[model samples]
Target: MDIGAIAAAVMLAVSVRKRLDVFDGPADITTSLMMVGPLLVLGWLVAIALFGGYREDVFGVGTDEYKRVFNASLVTAGMLGIGCYLAKFQLSRGFFLLAFVVGIPLLLMGRLLLRSAIHRARRQGRLQYRVLIAGSPAHVDEVAAVLRREPWLGYHVAGALVPAAHLAEETASGIPIVGTTEHSTALVSTEDADVIFFAGGALSSASQLRTIVWELEKAEVQVVVAPSVTDVSGERIKVRPVGGLPLMHIDPPRATDAARWGKRLFDIVAAAFLIVAFTPLMAYAALRVRLHDGGPVFFNQVRTGRDGEHFGCLKFRTMVVDAEARLAELHAQIGFEAGLFKMKEDPRITPPGRWLRRFSLDELPQLFNVLRGDMSLVGPRPPLPREVAGYESDMMRRLRVRPGMTGLWQVSGRSDLSWSEAVRLDLYYVDNWSMLQDLSILGRTFGAVFGSRGAY
Candidate 1:
C-alpha cells in the first residue's frame, strides 16, 4: 500500500510537470518509454516489497520500520535515476526530486492512519494472531507469561503442546495444555493457530525440529524460535553463519566516552529548554500549593542520582507539613508497597492535592532539578534513596544517566505498573538510549499525563 501510494503520487507529479504535449508532435520512442511508466512503478513497488517493507510487523508500526521504508524507496529511486540517465529519457529531474520528497511523507502518513485503526482493532480483540507453544511445562509457562505481558503484540496463546519425553506427561501452563508435541502440527491445524512458538527446554534434535518446521509449514502457520537466552538486548546480538551453522555473537555492554559525551550534551540541551518553558507553570503550581496547604510549597527529598550521587529532587508539596512525621503510622497501611511508595487516598494530602496528583502538576517543580543538573529531561525514573540502596546488579545500570521527572515509568503506566514491568521498561530505555527516543518519550509524556489513567 505504501509503495503503491508513493508510486501513483510520484507518477502524477511527473506527468503534470513534464506536460507531454502529445498532440503537438509526431510520436517517438520516448513516448513509448514514458507510456511504459506503470511497469516501472510496479517494479519499484516489488523492489520495496522484496526489501521487507511489506512484512506484517513493519507494515503498521514503529519509526524504525518507517525509516526502513524511506531507505528502500530512495534505493529504488536511485536505481531508476541510473536507468533514466542511461536511456537518455526526457524526464524532468526536478519533478522527480519533488515527488520523492513529497511522496515519502504521504506514504508514511497513510501508514500511520492505518496503524491507528489496526491498534484499535487489536485493543478490541478483533484482530489477533492465535499462537501455540511447544516445550516443557516451565518453558511453556515462561512463553505464556511473556504473551500476557505484551498485549500490544497481539498474540493469543491458544494452548501448549507438552511432550511426555520433555515432561512426564501433558502438563499445563496457565494457558490450556491441548496435546503432546507428537501431534503438535495436527493440534495447530485443528486449533487454527497463526503461529507456533518452540519454547526452549525441550530436548528435541535438530532433525526433529526440521521435521516439525516442515510439517507446520504445510499447516501454514509461521514458526518462531524461543532461545533460552534472557535479559539480552536485541541490538547486542549478531548472527553469523559459518559452515552452515549459525553462530550468535553477544557483544559486551560497553558505554564508551563518545556515547557519554553525546548523552551529556543531549541532557544539557533538553533540560535547559524544559526548565525555560515550564518556569511560569512551576511558579503558579508552587503558589497554589502554598495557598492551599499554608506551608512551604517545595517538597525536597534526597534521591540517588546518576552513579549513586545524592541530589535534592524538587516537587510541589502536595501533603501536609507533618506528612513525613506521620509516615511511620501510615507504613502499616495496606494496598501500597514499601520502597515504591503510594498513598492513593491518604488523609495527609491537601484538598487541592487530589487534582494536582491527578494531572501530575506536582512534578512541575522538577524542572528546577533538571536545570540544576541533578536530573535529565528524559532518563530512568529517579529512584528514592531506599529503592536505590536495595538495587539488584541490573537495576544500578539505570543510574548511569541522570534521573528524570518523567521517563519509561512515567510514560508506560506510572503508578499503575507492576514493579517488574517498571524495571523492564527502565532497562529497555537504558539499553536503547538515543536522542530521538528521548524526544519521542517526552512527547508521549503529555498524552499519558492528560489521560490520567495511572497518575494517582
Candidate 2:
C-alpha cells in the first residue's frame, strides 16, 4: 500500500510535467485532466492494500519478511504495468523506472523505521504480553531467563502452573507459582494471559496437553509448547493430522537430484562470475598472506564433500604455518575434547587472520571450490572427513548436498550453534532444497558475515 501510494506520486509528477508545458507555452484547461490519472493511481493503491500488501508482521524478522515485501510489490507493479499497456495509455518509461527505483527503498526504509519504533516501545514496556508458562521448574526457569534478558520480545512472565506432584516452590526467575496442574485451564482465564508456553519434560502426556489446549481454545489465548528434545529445528518436525489426532512426523533427511541439477547449474554460473570479479582481490589476499607470514598463500586441506567424497578445500592462510602442529599443545593447555577442540583465545591465529575471520575475508578463495564442483554457493557446512567418520546416521544427511561456502548454518548464528543445532540446520536445508531458498540464504549471508555474530 505504501509502495503503491509512493509510486502513484511518481506517476503524478510525470503527468504533471508532460501535461503542463509551462516551459514552452501557457497551460491550458485540458491540463487539469491530468488529475484523473492520480485518482486512478489512488484506487490502485487501495487495491494493492486490499490484496494484503500492507500487513507488516509477516515481514518482521529475517529474509522472509523482505521477500514478502519485494514479491508483493513486484507483482502489483507488473499487473499495473500490463493494465497501462492494454488500455493504450502511453505512460513515460522514465516514470515507471523512477517509481520502481524510488518506491522499493522507500517502502523498505519505512518498514525498518516501523520495526525499530515498535521494538523501542516494547523495550519501554508500553507494549507487553502477559504469558503463562506450563512445565517443570527447570524448563520454566530457562524460558523465563530468555524473556528477562530480552524484554523487547514482549513476554511478561505473569505466573506458572506446575504439575501437581512436582512440589517445586517457585520459578527460579521469580514468577509466582499460581496453581497446580489440575487447575491449569482455570488459572489461565483468571490470569488473563495472552500466551501460554507449555514448558519442558513435565508435560509428558500429550492427552493432558491436548486437554489444556482444548480449554485454552475457549479462552482464546495463544499456546506454544517447548518439546523435551533439545536443539531441534522446527523445519524437521511435521505435524500430520490423521483421523482425529495430530501426529508429529519427523522426516528423514535426504537431498535428491530433482532440483540438484538446477542448483548445480546456478552455482556454476554464479561462482564462475564471482571468481572472475574477485580475481584481483584474491591476488592481493595472496600477497598479504605471504608478506604477513612468509608461508604459503593458499592453504589446502582435505575436507569432506557430498556423499563422503574428499576434496581439497582452499582458504586464505589465516594462521601460522605450524598452526596445525600447535593444535595439540593448545588442546592440552585448554583440556578440550580429543575430537572437538576449541581454543577461545588461540595463539596460532596470524594478525591478518583475526581481521580476515572477523569479516569473513578469509573464505573468499572458496570461490575456486564452488567453481570446481567440489562446493556449492549454498548448502551444508563442510566438515572434516574425520568429523564425517564419527557421524550418526542422521548426521550423514548433511553430506547429501555439496558442501557450501555459505549455508543455513553459516547465516544462522554460525559457531554459536551447538553441534546438534548445526546438524539439524544442515539436514533441514537438504530436505527443503529450493533454488529460491538458496538465493534467499545467499542474500542473508551478507548480513550474517558483516554482522560478525559468531565468526570465530
Candidate 3:
C-alpha cells in the first residue's frame, strides 16, 4: 500500500506540476521523473521499514503506527532535498510540495483501511491469539474481563496459571485455571498460546518477575507484563530510564482541558452545521411524533450538567405523555440494577418512538443545547437528578465536562451498557479527551445508530 500510495502521489504531483506550469516542461528535469519515481518510492519504503513501521507490536493498536510513518516521511523528504541540491537536480517546486502534502495523507488512509480490516477480522474470531494469564485470582479475573470486553484487541484468554495455593478449575468470570506456577512453562506450549501475560501474584516483586520472564525466555511466545496501572492512555505515560530501571512518568488527567476553548469552538461549529444539515429531517421526525398521538413535539427534562448544574435536555418526544408515570411500574417488573432505569421492551414507548430511538433522531434537538453551551457534541451522558443522587465520588468526575449528545457509552452499547461500564467509558473519555478522539467517535455514531445494536 505504501508503495502504491507513493506511486500515485508521484503521478498526482506530475500532473499538478504541469497544471501550475512550475517548469518549462517534464524535459526540464535532468532525468525522466517516471524512472526516478520508482527509486524515490523505494527509498521511502526503506526509510519506513528501517523506522519500525513493520514492527509486530504496532499493528493492532495505538498511534505509534501513524507516528512512525509520519517520521519516516519527514526524514525521506529531508534526505531527498539534500541529495537533489548536491546533484544539481531541478525538482519542480510545485511537485515537491504536492508530493508530500498529498502522499502523506494517502499513506495514512491506507493504514486506516488496513487497521479497519484487522479489527473486522478479529471481531469475527479470525486472527486472534490464544493468551495464557499468570496471576492471582483477583488479577486474573480483572485481566480476563478487559480481554472479553474488547474482543477486537485479538486476545482470547485460554486459561490462567494462578499461585499454587489458589489453584482451581477456573477463576471467576469463567477463565479456566489451567495450572499452577509449577507447570507454567509447560502450559504455554501445551496450550499453544501466542502470548503469555504475567499479572500480579507471588510474581509481583521485580526479582520474582525477572525469574518468571527468564523461565519463559525459551517459550518463543510474546511475554507481556500487566502493570498495576489500568485505564491510563499511553499518551500520558512516558518512559524515563533511570540508573538501571525504566520509570514510568504519568501526566495528570486532562479533565480540565475538556473545558478549553478549542473543544467549545469545535462543539459550536459542529453542532451548528449539524443543525442546519438535519433541520428537514428533524422537522419530519418532530411532525411524526406530534401526529402519533398529538403529544408535544419535544421532551424537555431537567438533567445534571457540568459542575452539577441543572439544564433542560431537549429530545424529540419518543414516548407517551405518561411515560414518566409508568416508569415506576416498569422498574418494579425488572428490578433496577446499578441505579439506571432502562428496559429492552417498555410499554411506555409509543409506536413511532421505537424507530425514532432506534435511529437516534430523538436526540437531534440536543444540538440546540450544544449551541447553548449547556452541553458538548461529545462527552458523558447527562444524568437525571435521581441518577445524580446515587453517584459515588468517583462517578462525579463525569460532571467536570459538559454532557454530550452521543458519547463512548452510546457508541459502545447505549441503553444496553451496564451502569458500571457506562461510568467507566465516560470517565475514560473525560480523562483522555482529545479533538481527534471526538471526531472519531462522531464518525462512529452513525454506524452504531444505524445498526441499532443497543438502542431501544
Candidate 4:
C-alpha cells in the first residue's frame, strides 16, 4: 500500500507539473520524473517506516496510524523543500505545493479504504493475531472483554493465564484459563500466540514480568502492557526517566488561553461559512415547514450552555404545531424516561420533518446560535433545562464547555443512546477537548448522518 501511494503521488506530481507547464522540454520533465520523483518517494517511504507506519501494532487500529502518516508526509515535504533550496534545483513552487496537497489526502484515503477492507476480513475470522492474555482474574476478564468488544482491532484471544493461586473455575469473561502465569511460556508455545498482553497490576512484581519478557524473547512473541488508565490521548502523556526509572507524566487536560481562543475563532469562521453555504437548502427547508401545516418555520427551546448558562437553541421546525402539547401523551404511550425524551417513531413528526430529522437538516438554524456565541461548532450536546435540573455533580461538568450544534453524542448514537451513555460521552468530550478531536468528530458526523443510525 505504501509503494502504491508513493507511485500514485509521483504520477500525480508529474501530471500536474506537465499541465502547469513547469518543464522547459520533454527531457527536463523526463529527467525530473526519473530522478526527483523517485528520490522524494524514497525519502517519504523511509520517513514513514521510521515513524512505525509498517508496524502491525498500528495497522488495523485507531487514528495513531493516520497521524503518523500525516506527520511523515509533512516531514518529507519539509526535507524536500530544504533540499531543493540548498541544491538549487529550482523546482516550481506551485508544482511542489500541488504535489503535497493532492498526495496527502490521497494517501489518507487509500489507508482508510485499506483499513476498511482489513476490518471486513478480520470480522470474517481472517488475519487476526492469536493473543494470550496474562493477568489476575479480574484484570484478565476486564482486558478480554474489551478485546472482544472491538473485534476490528484484530486481536483474537487464544486463551488467558491467571495467577497460580487463583481458584476460579475459569475466566469469568468466557476466555478459557489455559494455565497459571507461572507457566505462561508453555502456554504461549502451546497456543502459538503472536502477542502477549499484560494488563496493568496483573503480574506479581516487575521482576517477574521482566523474567517473562526475557523468556519470551527467544520465542519471538510480542509483549504488550495495557495501562490501567485508558481513553487518554497520547499527546497528553509523556514518558520521562526519573532516578533511572521510566515514569509516565500525564499533563492536565486544560487548554491554554490561546488554544481556547483559537477554537472559538474556528467556530465563528466555520459557522459563518456553513450558514452562507447552506442558505439555499435552509430556505427550501423553511418553505417546506411553513407550507406543511402553516406553522412557524423555526423551533426555539431553552437549553443549557457553557457555565450552566441558559440559551434559546434553534432548529428548523420538524414537528407539527402544538408538538409540545402532545409530548406528554406520547411520552406516556411510548414509556420515555423523564430525563431524555426520545421516540423512534413519533406521531408528532410532519411528513417533511421526518426527512429533515433523518439527515439532520433540522439543525441548520443552529448556526445562528453558534454565530451568536450561544454555542460552538463542536462540543457537548445542548442539554434541555429539565435535563440540567436532573444532573448530579459529576454530570454537571459537561456545562464547562459551550453546547454544540452537533457533538460526540450526536455522532455516536443520537436519540438511541441511553441517558447515562449520553452523559458519559459528553463528559469524555469535555475532559479531552482538542482541535484534532473536534475535527475528527466533525468528520465522523457526516458518515453518521448518512448512515442514519439512531437518528430518529
Candidate 5:
C-alpha cells in the first residue's frame, strides 16, 4: 500500500509539474519521475521499516502505526531533499514539495483503509490469534470482557489459567477456565495459543513470572500484561523504567483543552461550514416539521452544558407539539431512566420526525447552537437537566466540556446504548479527547448517520 501511494504521488507530482511548466521550468516531467520514483519509494520503505512502522504488535489498534508512518515519510522527504542538494541535482523544487505533501496523506489513508479491512476480517473470525489468559478468575473475566467488546482486536480467548485459589469452571465473562496460572506454559502449548495475557494475580512473585516468560519464550508466544488500569488512552500513559522495573506515568486529563482557543476556533469554522453546506436539508426538515400538524419548526429543550450551565439545545421538531406532555405515558415502557431516556418506538414521534431522526437531520438545528456557543461540533452528549440532576459524582465529568451536537454517544450506537455504557463513553471522551480524535469521530459520523444503525 505504501509503495502504491508513493508511486501515485510521484506520478501526480510529475503531471502537476508539467502543467505548471510556465513558471516551474519542467516541460518534460515524466522522464525524470520514471528515473527517480522507484528509488524514492525504496528509500521510503526502508525508512519506514527502520522506524518500526511495520511492527506486528502495533497493528490492529491505536494511532501509533499512523504516527510512525507520518514520521517516516517526513524523514524520507528530508533525506531526499538533502541528498539532491548535496549532489547538485535539480530535483524540481515544486515536484519535491508536491510528492511528499500528497504522498504522506495517501500513505496514512492507505494504512487507515488497510486497518478497516483487517478489522472486518477479524470480526468475521479470520486472522485471529488464539489467546491464553493468566489471571485471577475476577481479573480474567475483566480481560475477557474487553476482548469480547471489541472482537476486531482479533484475540480469540481460548480459555483462562487463573490463580489456583480462585479456580472456577468459567470466567463470569464466559471464558472457560482451563488451568491454574502456574501451568501457563503447558496450557499455551496444549491450547495452541499465540498470545498469553497476564492480568492481576497471574504470578506469585517476580521470579515465578520470569520463569514462565523464559519457558514461553521457546514457544514463540507473545506475552502481554494487562494492568488493573482501564479506560486510559495511550497518549496519557507513558512507561518509565526505574530500578529495573517499569512504572506507568499517567498524565493529567486534558479536558481543559476543550476550552482552548484552537478547539473553539475549529468548532466555529467547522460548524459554520456544515451549516452552510446543509442549509437546504435543514430548511426542508424545518418545513416538514412545521407542516406536520402545525407544530413549531424547531424544538428547544433546556440541557446541561459545560460547568452545569443550562442551555437551550435546538433540534428540528422530532415529535408532536405535546411530546413532553405525553412523556409520562411511556415512562413505564422505557423503565424511567435517569441518565439518557430513549425508546425504539416512542409513540410521541411524528411521521416526519421518524425520518429526520433516522438520518440525524433533526439535530441539524444544533449546528446553530454550535455557532451560538451553546454546543460544539464534537464533545460529550448534551444531557437533559433532569439527567444532570441525577448524575453520580463520576458522571458529572461529562460537564467539563461543552455538550456536543454529535459525540461518542451519537456514533457508538446512539439511542441503542444503555445509559451506563453511554455515560462511560462520554466520560472517556471527556478524559481523552484530542483534535485528532475529534476529526476521526467526525469521519465516522458520516457512516453512522448514513447507516442509521441505532437512530430511532
Candidate 6:
C-alpha cells in the first residue's frame, strides 16, 4: 500500500508539472520516473518503517496507525525538501505540494477501508486471537465483558484462569474457568491461546508479572496488562520509572486558555460559513413552518449553556403551538422520564414538522446560537433547564464546555439513546475533546444527518 501510494503521488506530480509547464529543467519524464521516483519511494518507505507504521501492536485498531502514517509523511516531506535544497534540484513547489496533498488522503482512506474490512472479518469470528484471561474473578468478569462488547477489537475470550479458591465458580462473565492462575502456562498450552490478559492487579507484584511475561514469551504467547483506570486517553498517561518501578502519570483533562480561544474562533468561522451556505434551505424551512401552522416560525427555548448559564437555543418550529401544553399528556402516554422527552410519532407534530425533524432541518437555526457564543459547532448537546435540574453532580461536568448544534450523542444515537448512555457520552466529549476530534465529529455529522439513523 505504501509503495502504491508513493507511485501514485509521483505520477500525479509528473502529470501536474507537464500540464502546467512549471518545471524549468529538462522535462525528461522517462529519466525522472526511473531515477527520482525510485529514490523518493524508498525514502518514504524507510521513513514509514522508522516511525513504527508497520508495528503489529497498532494493526487493525485505534488511531495509532493513522498517527504513525501522518508522522511518517511529515518526516518524508521534510527529507525530500532538504534533499532538493542541498542538491539544487529545480523541483516545482506546486508539484510537491499537490502530490503530498493528494497522497495523504489517499493513504488514510486506503487504511480506513482496510480497517473496516478487518473489523467485518473479526465480527464474523474470523481473524480473532484466542485470549486466556488471568485475573481475580471480578477482574476477569470485567475484562471479559469489555472484550465481549467490542468484538471488533479482535480478541475472543477462550476462558479464564482464576485463583484456586474461586475454581468452584463455573464461569466468569460466561467464560469458563479453565484453571488457577498458578497453572496459567499449562492452561495456555492446553487451550492453544494466543494471548494472556492480566486485568486489575492480577499478579502479586511487578516481579511476579514480569516472570509470567517471560514465561509467556518463551511460549510465543503475548501478554497484556490492563490497569484499573478507565475512560482516559493514552495521550494523558505517561509511564515513568521511579527506583526501577514503573509509575503512570496522568494529566488533568482541562484545555489551556489558548486552545479554548482557538476552539471559539473555529466555531465562529464554521458557523458563519454554514449560515451563509445554508441560508436558502433555512429560508425554505422557515417558510414551510410558517405556512404549516400560521404560528411562530422560530422556536426559542431556555437551555443550559457553559458553566450552567441559561441561553435561548433557537430552532425552526417543528411542532404545534400547544406542544408544551400537551407535554404532560404525551409523557404519560409514552412513559418517558423527564430527563429525555422524545416520541417517534407525536400527535403535536405537523405534516411538515415530521419531515423537518427526520432530516434535522429543524436544528439549522442553531447555527445562529453558535454564532452568538451560546453554543459551538461541535460539543455536548444542550439540555433543557428542567433536565439540568435533574442532573447528578458528575453529570454536570458536561456543562463545562459550550453546548453544540450536533454532538457526540446526536451522531451516535440521538433520541434513541438511553438517558444514562447519553450522559456518559456527553461527559466523555467534555473531557476528551480536541480540535481533531471536533473536526472528526463534524465530518461524521453529515453522514449521520443523511442516514437519519436515530434523528426522529
lDDT of each residue in 181-220, candidate 1, tens digit only: 7787788889999998888755367778788888866667
Better of 3 and 5 by TM-score: 5
TM-scores of all candidate predictions against the true structure:
0.84, 0.75, 0.92, 0.88, 0.96, 0.91
lDDT score, candidate 2: 0.74
lDDT of 2 by residue, 1-456 (tens): 464547555655555656644354432323433643564456545654665556644544444455555666677578767877898765555555555566667666677777667777888997788988887777878778767756767788988878887656577767788887678778888998888888775575779888888877877788887655443334557888899777777655337851367888888899889888988978887888899969998889899998889999999999999988887788678776633344455688888888778788888889889888899989888899778778889888788779999998888778777776677778778876766678879988998999998887
Compose the digit string of candidate 3's lDDT tens values, residues 77-147.
99988988998887776777788999999998999999989999999999989999999989988888888
What are the Cα lDDT values of the candidates? 0.75, 0.74, 0.87, 0.83, 0.88, 0.83
Q: What is candidate 4's local distance difference test score?
A: 0.83
RMSD after CA superposition, every candidate: 4.9, 5.5, 2.4, 3.1, 1.6, 2.6
Backbone clashes, each candidate: 0, 1, 0, 0, 0, 0
lDDT of 4 at 426: 82
Model 1, which residues run further than 4 Å from truth?
1-47, 60-64, 76-98, 165-173, 254-259, 335-337
Better of 3 and 4 by TM-score: 3
lDDT string, candidate 6, 35-141, tens digits: 66778788888988899999999877768899999889888888888988999976667667777888888788888889989988998999999999888888888
What lDDT score goes with residue 321 in model 2? 97
lDDT of 4 by residue, 159-214 (tens): 88887787455877678888888888888999899999998545877888889889
Query: Clashes in model 1: which pairs?
Result: none
1 or 5, greater by TM-score: 5
Top candidate when judged by TM-score against the true structure: 5
> Per-residue lDDT of 307-350 in model 5, one digit per residue for the tens?
99999998888898888988887887667856577787888899
Clashes of 1: 0
